[model samples]
Each structure stands twice: as structure tokens, then as C-alpha cells.
Target: MKAFLDILKPNQLIYPNTVGYDWNQVDVNRPQGHPYYHWLQTNQGEGVVNIDNKSIILSKNDGILITPFTPHKYQSDQFWTTNFITICGYASIFFQKQLGEKKYFVLRESSCVDKDIYNLTNKLDSSCDDAQISLQTYKIFLDILHGVQQVSAEGYKSIPICWEIKNYIDDNYMEKISIKKIGRLFNISPQYIIKVFKQAFNISPYRYLTKKRISEAEKLLISNKDLLISEVANLVGFDGASHFIDVFKRVENCTPLEFRLIYYQGADFNHE
Candidate 1:
């Protein structure tokens, strides 16, 4: 009976099991921090995550694993926008159960996940029965757990660049940064920089930079509905709205308008 009562609470039961599968989008006028359980975050837009001594600029194809109750906050870093999803509560236990004990997990946002998330968001928007959504979300939660576990098991094979690259992107993505800039900053040659970084990250420096820009653009579009699409494009370094749209369509397989409609008009994704 005590356990049953625990399950009835809005905070506990709605999280973890039922919540992990859904996506939530938020925009705060100011910085906000929270104590969360297990949460996975993939940045949809241009922003930076500052937690403890670490900072990460959200880029396309980057995913983050945030441990429970680790105080964290996000900032735009520029006028750029930010977007992401967080899963908390018992659902995090799914990851813990699979991956063993790790304080946090972070994946660089990937274009691969864009479609999956879009589909999940659509399913969430369906005015289907609550029981159905609940069951479906549970399944999705398991899928997310599997994804993180796969990344974890792959070890450095997946993310070979030093974590410092992630940090550098966070602090400097908004700035005009190049491989040469990075190489100079770290006292290395451009050629050596390309070799080591690619060896470590399995991706070239240019790919990393472009991905970062696209990710930031995604966040801005979703989080700041009031902002114009052209503005979002410019904020992320695109020359114009058309260019941004073309790039986004190619990578996400949807036009900017389509993406926005799906994201905003879709159902509210609630965990649990």
C-alpha cells in the first residue's frame, strides 16, 4: 500500500517509467537550475550547458547523460536559441540498470536521432488514450536506455576526441573558431590537429563545426517560437533563411517550416 501511494504522486510515478520516452521543450527568461534524477539531453539548438566545472555547447548529434541531482544550468552563449529533452525519475534506473554506475553520459547530438525524435513526438501528440500513451512511452524509454548503453559499451570508440573538444565547442561555437584556431590555442599544427582529432572523434573538424551550428539552429527554432526563422538562421551563422532551410532539410529530412510545425503543434510529451 505504501508503494502504491508512492506511485500516485505526480512527481514520482509520472517520471522514470512513463516519462523517459517523451520529450519536453522549454525556454526560460533567465537561467534555471534543478536537481534531477537520471536525464538524457540532446540539444536541438545553439546553447551551452554549464554544470560543475564543465561546459558543453550543444551541437547536432550530441547527446548528454546527466546523473540524478547534479545541479546544472544552460545559457544561450549568444542570442542563439536552445532546445532539448530531459527524462527523469525511476525511468533513469533503466539506464543505471544497463550501464552500471556512471555519474553522467553525454552524446554529441546526432542527425540520426532527428527522425526518431520527430516520430516519437508525433506519437506523443496523438490524442490517443492515456493507457496507450503510457505503454508506448515505456517502450520508447527502453529504446532510449538501449541507445545510451550502446554508446557506453562502445567506449572511446565512439567519442575519441578529448572531452576538451566538447568543452571548447561549448565555450567557443558562437565565436569564429576554426581548426587552425583550435590548433593554435592548443599549440599544435593544423595537420596534426586534423589527424589526432579525427582519430579521436571519428569525424573531421569541419563536420564537427557544421553539426554544432545546425544543432544550435534547431534549438532556437523550437524554443523561441516568437523569433523569426530568418533570425534563427542568422544567429547560427547561416547566410540567409533559404540556406538554413536547405541545410536543415537535407540533414533532418524536413523543411524548417515542417520541423517547426511538428515541434510546436505536436502533443505535449509527458513522462509517466
Candidate 2:
């Protein structure tokens, strides 16, 4: 098996400069809009944005990506809740290219205010370094782009297909899974399964399952001290210890035994 790092593309060049989720929505009177691309979405209730010569009513799952310095203002008529992020990075130009001529995009099904993003923002602490924060921000930015592009291609009414598969994988990672089985279960084609899955998660279903299995295996290895390597492999749906070791090494840069040894004996390094 190729190393897991080999599956990833080069690091994303885009990142969020600032992020806010679950803030009480309020009026903004920016006749001259703020700098940087601002992506704002509604978490609950309703809001409105006036731009060009129109007042756009935004409901649930409605998000707008305001291009830099576009004169605009928004208001919350009632008890509206919202989330927003300001983005900047080396990849700004590339984002603009993908965004095309739209001064602002009314992205459909884009509740960027979802619990996942909110939780991440909540967990961010002072100890997180620039690189760490940037990596996570890049992921959020990429997810936004993915949602935007999906809606742009398939129209506003299109359901989120990738997430269905993702949830399935998450639930059944300990069992054998196949792309064909996923397609049949989800009523999508195999080729389409790969396409959307890769677009959303940046990996194929098989690789994701392997990684998930390895992650669970790591937990079993650590938590259940007396379990044999073969038992760990079996519990994680691996066929045998040797195959499990090969895949575990490819993903983790160490054998399962080595990981367990280092994890338990890591305290010895403190003595040194």
C-alpha cells in the first residue's frame, strides 16, 4: 500500500483569516464593504443583504460570498443567528478564478454555520500554532468551495450525496465495504461514487475505510492492553496480522507493534 500522505495533494493554499459561528445576527451598515472575501451564512431565523440595487432575503441554508470591497450592508429583521468567515491566503487568486464573475454568490444548501465548523472554532485555543490553525482553516475553506461548486453544477435542489456515503462509511467502517455496494445502496453509479467521494473527502472509499479501520485499531491497541495483534486486526476487519501490519505501516509510518510500544514507553523519553 502507498503511504497515506501520497494520496493527499499539496497543502491547500487558501485559508480563513477569521471565523465566527453562532453569533446573534445584526445589522451591518458598511456602505463601503470591508476588505477580504467574507462568507456569511444563517444558522437560524432570517436575514437580508442589500447589494447593487436589491435586498436579497436569505433563509436557512442560504449563504453569500461577498467579494472584497463590494459596497453592501446586511440586517437581521428578527432574532437571527449567523456564522461568518473572512478568508485570505496565497490561493486567493485561484479562489477568484473558481468564483468567476459573480460579485457575490447566493450559495444554496450552504449552511456554513453547521455544528462541525462551530465545534472546531470553539475548540481552537491559544496553544494552536499558525500552521495548525491554517491547516484547519484551509479545510473549512475547501468545504465551502466544494458545497458552492456542487450547487453550481447540480442546481439548488440537488441533495448532498457525498455526505450520505460518508455517514455510511463512518457507521460501517468495521465491516467490509465495496464501492459497488455503496453505489447500489445510495442509488448512484460506481464512477460517480468515486468522483463525489474524492471531491468531498479527497480520497476514495477503500482508502477511507482503511484509514478508519486503522484509526479504530489504534484505539483498540491502546485501550485493550492484552489484545493480541491478530485480535486487533480481526476486530478492525483486517484479514490477517501481516496485511494489517503492512497497511498500518503505510498509513502511520510504523508497525502496529511499534506504535503500541512507543505509545506505552513514550514516558521513557521524558527520563532521557
Winner by TM-score: 2
Please identify model 1 stretches exceeding 4 Å from their true place.
1-17, 20-161, 266-272
> In model 1, where is the ten-residue run with the lowest total lDDT?
1-10
**lDDT winner:** 2
Residue lDDT tens for model 2, 126-226? 44544455555555665776666555545422437877887798798877789989988988899988987777655687887897798678667756668
TM-scores for all predictions = 0.43, 0.51
Q: Candidate 2: give the clashing pairs.
A: none
Q: Evaluate residue 198 in candidate 2 and report its C-alpha lDDT on the 0 to 100 scale.
A: 77
Report the C-alpha lDDT of model 1 over 1-272, residue by residue, as the tens digit: 00000122232212322222223333332233434443334434455666666777666446555665666665554443222334443324334534456656666544444444444455555645433333334444445544664464365555444456656865666667788788778776889767766666556776666666776775666557788889888888777889888887766556666655544454223322
Clash counts for all predictions? 25, 0
The global Cα lDDT (0 to 1) of model 1 is 0.53
